[model samples]
Structure formats: structure tokens, C-alpha cells
Target: MVAMVASSLFASLDKDGDGKVSASELRGCMAAALGEDMSEEEAAAILAAADADGDGLLDRDEFLSLAREAECAADEGGRYECLREAFGMYANAADGEEQCITPASLKEMLSRLLGTSQHLGMEECRAMICRFDLNGDGVLSFDEFRVMMHDGLM
Candidate 1:
């Protein structure tokens, strides 16, 4: 039943029938849902968050995860919650709790997203945080994280 629902949603979004969902297709759906167009940055943020294999497209499992999120999200606030849920996926919080996106968590998540078998070095992660850490606290608050995801999009 779940798989059927997932495939149905994926089929609806995979307009090109390429066995993957592109950012453009997703953008269209989001635009309809939000009643306004989504910028390329916002679309890219969604894809970047969900594209586990780093293919720049959403395959079944990836799309299914995102679709499941959207299933519970019906409006703008729900949309934000969906993104937050995606953000939570990469949470590698130390001490078994997450308050923000720290260098260590960013390092782990980026290494996985970049498909790097080796760690993505602490210095690089710190640099990434520095670029968008508006608070200068050496970590990414959700707002900072959103800026980084939507702007830098790495």
C-alpha cells in the first residue's frame, strides 16, 4: 500500500518518465502548493536534501522519503517542516542531541552527500559553516542552515 502510494506520487512528479524526478518537476508541484513560484535555489535545496546518491535527481527511495514528508505537509508552514525533517536526517549530533548544524555534523553529512568514502576534513567543514554562520557562533542555526542550503547549496 505504501509502495503503491509512493509510486503513484513519484509517477505524478516524474513527468519526464526518466525514472527520476528533476528539480523543475518538483518546482512546479511546489509552486502549485505554495501558490507561487519557487526559486531555483529553493528547488535545489529540496533536491540537495533528498538526493542521497548525489545524482541531482530523486530516485524512488529518495522521492518516496520526500513525498512522505509532503504527505504530512499541506501548506507553507508544513513545507518548512518538511525541509526541517530533511535537515534532521543528516543530524549527526554529538552527545545524542542536536541544537544546530555543527562542524562535525556538517562534515559527516557532506562527506556522505559528496559520496566521499573518506572524511571531509574538519577545516573544510568549518569553512563551509563560516560562509553562512550569520551569528558567528561557529555553527549553523536553522536560519543559517537554510541560507547555506538555499544559497551555497553544497
Candidate 2:
């Protein structure tokens, strides 16, 4: 099923009737699919992370990776894994060595989640940290992130 979905998505993204998906095509497809444009940084990061063959374009096998990831995100356990992946991604992206999300990164993450670079204010991010930061360390650990993501689950 995921294979079929990936094939269909690949077909749609392969603009200009090409058999591969370039980074630009992927950026446009992401914007159309999400109803918000992805920043160049985001698109580039995605391409770098997912481009398996080092070809600078996504072929069938490469696109299947995203399809599989999306399939995982659709399930409950996979949702937890997805959250963990997101936390790890940000934690590793940060300059600090604590393996946690800094407040500034958290603010940017919130803004991204809100679908705009400036949709979320620093104050709002601070308030959110106050609400979820159990250790009061001014940064979000994976536990804190899980709590925030699963606020309604409990």
C-alpha cells in the first residue's frame, strides 16, 4: 500500500515529466500539500537527509523512504517514534551538547509547527516552556517534549 502511495506521489512530484523529483519540485510539492511554503533551509535539509543515492534528486527508492516514514507517523507507536525523531533532530541541530532543545530552537520549532516563520512569538514559546518544562532548565528534554505532544493523551 505504501509502495502504491509512494508511486502515486512520485508521479505527481515528477514535474516536467521527468522520472525523478528534484529539490525544487519537492519544495513546491511540499508547499502545495501542506498549504504553506517550506523555507529553503527546510527543503535543503530534507533533501540532504533523505537523498539516499547522493544524486541530488529523489528516485523511486528514495521517495519510498518518505512514504514509509509517513506510514509510520500514521500509527500510534510510530507517532511516538516520530516525536522522538523530531526531538533528536532538533537536539542534534542545536549548538549545545546537552541533547536538548534550547528555548530559541523551541520557539523556531513552534513557529514552524504553526506553519510560518513568525507565527509564534518568543513570549508564547516562553509560556509553553513554563507549562511543560518539568525540570525548569529553560530547555526541553525528550520527556518534556513527550509531555507537550501528549498533553491531551493524559
Candidate 3:
């Protein structure tokens, strides 16, 4: 079933009657799948991230990887839940009350997000806290995090 679906998808994406999906073809496919015209930069980034070979095109396997990633990322609700779960994982303060992510924890999360080789400096972390801290308590409550995540803060 999966093979048949992938074959059909590949055929659809291989525009211009080409045997392979070029970068432009992949970008068009993504735009169509996402129901919006993706920016050139976004399309290029997706192609670069998924293209295993140096060639700037997506073969069947590469396209399958992109499809899987897009499938996961397209679920906004699931993404939010995953983010909430991450917040909970890092907000581990056994104070027996409502706990929040401290500046230190936020820094750790940011560092992890950016990769361990490039940890954000204290100044950067503080700035992020300042941006997200609604009540100005120097830490992020779950509500504040929700607002930051879902309420147009991006």
C-alpha cells in the first residue's frame, strides 16, 4: 500500500513529464501539498534538508523522507502537544505546586534546540525570557508559554 501511494505521489510530483523531481518540481509539490505558495527560501531549505545526495533533486527515497517530515510537521495540534510535553519535561521543580520553566531551563532548551555545540549566552536567554515573560516573574508559566507558542508570538 505504501509503495503504491509513494509511486503515485512521485508521479504527481514529477512535473514536466520528467523522470525525476527537480528542485522546482519539489517546491511546486510542497506548495500544492501545503495549500499555500511556499517561499523560495522555504522550498530550498526543505530540499536541502532532505536531499541526501549533492544533487539538487529528490529521488523516491528522498521524497519519501520529505513527505514523512511534512506529515509530522503539518499536525499543528500534535506539534503543540509535543511542545507542551517538552516544557513539562524541562520544568521539573518539585515544589509541590504549579511549576514553570526557569531562565536556566529555558536556556537549556534553547541550547538543545540549536544543538549542543552552540549554546545561547546568558544575555540571549534573558532576552528570550523578557520577551515571553508576561507577568514579569522572570520565569515562564505554562499559560505564558501557551501564549507565546499559540497566540501569534511565533
Best by lDDT: 1
lDDT of all predictions: 0.72, 0.70, 0.69
Per-residue lDDT, model 1, residue 25, is 83
Which 10-residue window of candidate 2 scores lowest in summed lDDT? 109-118
lDDT of 1: 0.72
Instruction: Look at candidate 2 and tell me the lDDT of residue 148.
Output: 74
Q: RMSD of candidate 3 to the true fold?
A: 14.2
Clashes by residue pair, model 3: none
Off by over 4 Å in 2: 69-154
lDDT, candidate 1, 48-116, per-residue tens: 999999989999889888766665555768757756875675554668555687888777655543333
Candidate 3 lDDT over residue span 17-133, tens digit each: 566677677676555444357777776776778889958777888877765665557587887776687578557475686878887876765554333445678778778778889
In model 1, the worst 10-residue window by lDDT is: 109-118
Q: Could you tell me how far off, in angstroms, the CA of residue 147 lies in candidate 3 after the best superposition? A: 0.7
TM-score of model 1 vs. true structure:
0.45
| Model 2 lDDT per residue over 102-139, tens place | 76777655444333423667777677677878999877
Please list all clashing residue pairs in model 2, or write none if there are none: none
Q: State residue 44's C-alpha deviation in candidate 2, in Å.
A: 1.6
Per-candidate TM-scores read 0.45, 0.46, 0.47
Model 1 bad stretches (over 4 Å): 1-75, 92-98, 117-119, 151-154
